[model samples]
Target chain A: MINTEKIVEVQNLNFSYGQVNVLSDVNMSIHLGEFLAVIGPNGGGKSTLVKILLGILKPDSGKVRVFGKKPGTSKSVGYVPQDFSAGRGFPVTVREVAMMGRALAGKGTTKAEDKDVVDKILNDLTLIDSSEKRMDDLSGGQRQRALMARALAVEPEILILDEPASNLDMIGQTRIFDLLAQLNKNMTVVVVSHDLTIIPKYATSVACVSGNVHKHDEAEVTEDMIHQSYGGVEGCPVELVAHGHPHRVLKEHDH
Target chain B: MMELLSFGFMQNAIMASILASVACGIIGSLVVVNRIVFISGGIAHTAYGGIGLAFFLGISPLLGAGVFAVTAAVIMALITKDNKYRADTVIGAMWAFGMAIGIILLDLTPGYNVDLMSYLFGSILAVPKSDLVYMFILDGMIIAYILTWYRQIHAVSFDSEFASSMGVRSDLIYMSMLVMSALAVVLLIRVVGLILIISMLTIPPYMAERRSNSLKGMMIYATLFSLVFSLVGLVMSYFFNLTSGASIIFVSAICFFLSLIYDRVRTSK
Candidate 1:
């Protein structure tokens, strides 16, 4: 029987961009309060699937539900998109950027309460001191923190992240992982990342999708299983290769 | 002064400045925030082609400019959508193409002894009553649109994909922004002329950024600064016999420098 405790349910989800089919027959159920990490190679539909769940992109023929409602219709879902290397010049402050999520909450008439909610999120992110600093002036890690703070301002029951550790160095990546762990305690967290180093330790459940898809709960994750999914030969756990490339065992993952 | 106010042309200039200030201020804030200043500059200059087209077709220059500017804005938007690095290159090519086309068309219009300098530099003194009315209506639309759609606009400017994921229509929002920019560019050309229009569109918002937190507040401050500067410029132009557009830009530049100094002083403490 399907789990009644599920918060996110995707059934037979299929998606594509133009003629290229990215995701097909993807069915998954994420229980309430689960921390799920989605790891895949470059162009492996990781971002596409997360985008579908977040309502940024629609699946051709599938169902996606968040807390029993359509994905984007759920006010309780939060998202942090990959930092796409926007250059300097925009003069937005960190506080103002974070407030975007709160501003989008509900309809129009709740500005006062919205401010209070955003303030709380900033406090939780430890970003209160630098809130007034311009986003352009922030350090790389600080900018990422501000992005996280923006997502948290939604007070989401579920949080989605895409390549949260892409450009971060070791320290920055660790800090972001720690922050995600803290957030996972309060919400269902789903992360789409290619940083395989983080998967074994930080992830409670790991889902690998290339052409085919598979999932392993925290206890069920074995090194050989990771090698099989990622096609790392000679009995090493799957590791991120150079430049986000994947060497997989099965040609079926190449659809 | 009351005698000067009695002149219909003087009243038209005042109304035109007010209308132009509001449009330029709001749209300029978006341009500055989104870092599309150079593209907007290209759009303004490229609009000169429309003025030439209007002369050739015996239509109003404003109508030609409207069509020309919107077309340019869309082209620029599409070209720069996926390629941010090539923005300047594309804008430069379009800028030269627009000016060249305008000059060629203007030459082809026989017996057209046009006062081209007035179009290049604004002739606020010649602003028609009907144009003033158009400006007012457009300003009203800009105000209503900004207030009703502030959050969505802010989100798109900051993080488009995230905004899209939140169910905000980023594409619609982007198109609307371009349309507003087109309207602003057209109105600004009427009051400040194409040569000096970009300064008015960019300077006030640049000054306001030193003090404001949110885009909404930045826009209000920009409007106030633009209004004050344009008024001062108008009076100075009257007293000193200067070009209306250049005088206005001069005053805003002073404001920009002053705001910078004020920001530095506050931070030094």
Candidate 2:
């Protein structure tokens, strides 16, 4: 049961980094309660598109709206950036990091309600015991979960994550995806991932981004989409191991 | 030490040290966590231009330094906000350019009998009572700033992108931090001199960063460390007839290395 209310709308988006065109003529829309997975090869403007959607980067010529307003003008969106360890070596605890989510949402005061929200999110993430621990002391998986807790602490209507599980192991990746799947039942989720194998299991829809965006209406990754998004490289060795299915999406290339 | 306290000049130096520690503890923690030590050094050196302008205009050097430092900070913030990769090059050039401007301005001034060494290496013993008032006011402002906007500053420092996404005005916060760093540099110039100010702004915070679990804790511990080093270094300078700024920095450096060794030994165990 997908909600038809459009939560994010992008139109004729054109973006470039100092004359090197990244996204051109891209258009996409995300409805309420959508779980959109943005996928592409490196330098394919996957992260750039997410940034533009979050209003972190403005497009050259296009319109991006989140919740019917300009991106970043609304406080209903939470983001977990690709660089999860940006706070490493800094003297900030896990609870403090999560509390930062509430920093901009309301008057900057640590009310008891805000503390309760942070504690609940930390507990949900299984980080209640380490809530007082420094961010530098956490393991990679723990750090990822802590950052996710920060994003969730906002209690946002939409959550956006860029490469949330890039450095995680198989089990760690599965756990993160499971959490996202659980969270998607309530709020809209936008995830940028390079792992093609795991996305089909959780994503409600997929948008293949290269020089432009090709959105699929369902959670299915075809070989043609991968080939098209990867610039149609001849016999590109992109391994798409589909779970709960016996077929490989791409042909096995010999060494 | 009891006898020394009887002297008004010694009392003023101690007051200045305490005020300087407060500024360094708060602002230096931000500087270290943001990894903006080089930017801070650039701002401090650039303040020399202000000192020279003040001498030429027959005004207070600290006033001149404050104006020049804040202006330099704004310019640095603007240039570095978008051009992060080349920030060091820009800051380095500005650092030398400012010193050269100061030298030229001082040379052009008539009847320049000022002891430039005092400004370069610090004469904390000669600090007047008026400067202490300014230092006190600056400390109060820094404290008020932290109390009022601690959460926003924390968010911006930890992750500016996420902060911005959540409507924290991260760019504004970043610029304000740099401006605050410049003001802290101004507050420190009298106690440690321009060249040694960066050391005071970094060493204690760096040591505290390893021991603390929160930014506030880091600031408190850093302030304590800075206070101890200032007192110890002031006493050593009095007894050994040494330069006050250099002695203070020496004390901090010794403690920094010892902390490093202690961490290594404990970690191995």
Candidate 3:
């Protein structure tokens, strides 16, 4: 039974690309302001699931809804598509790129006030100095932030991200996580990541994906679960707290 | 040179160049920004099929090319939509087939060993009054479309997926762009031959892109640059007895090179 209050609802969702089953019978519901982290191994249909939710791809069978409407209806869904090709040499100004988020907001003419709004967004994202610079001139971390600024300008009620922190360093990663935490305070946010370390600190609920679906309810993700989810290695230390209970990560290991 | 401009043919060539350049430059800006240069090139060449059909059917070649290119542009637009990456391959195949069919049809058209060179290579020196009227109408339509939906076109050209998410039907906008580009190609077929049409389409904007920050600024500068290139090329062609179309493209090429040098020098400074 789907809760009517759910912002995103997916049931019996199966997706495949020409006989390769990526996801099967996946069921999940995300409530308003919920921060859900989907962690999985490579080739675990993480991106496939995100694309389906964004209405970019359709499932072979199942149901999906956004904000009590179709997947694409909520112009309020801000998706920063997995940065597959955002490299240097894409010739566009940071301000121009960010303005794209406001492209659909009932067009007439961009008033002088709209420029001020974009300027504020650039400042909030710490991109104000480089707003006039071409996208190709920005560093990788700055480029990622520019993409995020674009997404933020859309005023999305649901923010969906795919491996947004994969390219960032330790500082970059922490800054992005902090931003996500602040964003999730007001909107529903779903992030798909392969990283297991950052899941517990920020994710309100963790969903494990491995061609199958497993849901955990606010449980502190244990290292044993990570090992089980990622497939255990031979030399990795494993400790048992009790039968049927395992926790390998201690305070020292936590970043 | 001033006295030569008194002739109706010389005046017509000048008008044709100005009209065709403005239309092509504006449409070409969208093409370059969207990375649809090759597809626009394909549309320009494929217009030959329409010319051949017009000759065979005893109608105006411009009308025939207009009808045929518009139809093909729509089909090309549809096939390419939802598959932006693979669009060029489909357009390339269509371009080759369209050209082949046109040549075959031209050969089969009876009572017509018509000088194919004039149409294929362009005869700006021989442009008629009727052609000028046609150019005027096309120019009007182009201006209206650009004025009414300029912002939407800019957004779609920059990033279509983002545009569509914003309630703009990128499919519709993409199709409109293809149709307009094809029409512009059809208009330029007589001013500059199909062989040289894409150069006119690309060169002006390429030069303008170096000096401008916004797309609109690039287009306006391109129009002014194209006008200067056309006049210089015309005078050069008249004096040297060279082909008008080829001479025009040569002057534009020089401008493109100069623009590149200027940008390099400025950046170094």
Assess each model's interface with DockQ, reporting 2 decimals per model: 0.38, 0.66, 0.23
Candidate 3 C-alpha lDDT tens digits along A109-161: 56576677778889988999999887767877887788777777777888888
Model 3's A-chain: what TM-score? 0.83
- The segments of candidate 2 whose C-alpha lies over 4 angstroms from its true place after superposition are A107-110, A219-255
Better of 2 and 3 by DockQ: 2
Interface alpha-carbon RMSD, every candidate: 2.6, 1.5, 3.5
Q: What is the lDDT of residue B5 in candidate 1?
A: 79
**Which candidate, 1 or 3, has the higher TM-score?**
3
What's the TM-score of each model vs. the native? 0.82, 0.94, 0.86
Deviation of model 2 at A142, angstroms: 0.8
Best-to-worst lDDT order: 2, 1, 3
| CA lDDT scores, all candidates in order | 0.79, 0.86, 0.76
Native-referenced Cα lDDT, model 2: 0.86
Which residue pairs come into collision in candidate 1? A211-A253
Model 1 off-target regions past 4 Å?
A: A1-31, A42-45, A58-73, A82-95, A107-109, A128-142, A165-175, A194-197, A209-212, A218-228, A232-255, B1-8, B82-97, B108-110, B254-269
Q: After superposition, how far is residue A56 of candidate 3 from its true place, in Å?
A: 2.6
Q: List, residue by residue over B1-269, the lDDT tens digit for candidate 1.
A: 77877888888888888888888779999888777788888888899999999999888888888899889988887777657458789889998888889889999998898889878888787788878877788788889999899889888888888887777887788877877887798888767899888898889888876667667778888888899998888878877889888888888898788888988999899
- Candidate with top DockQ is 2
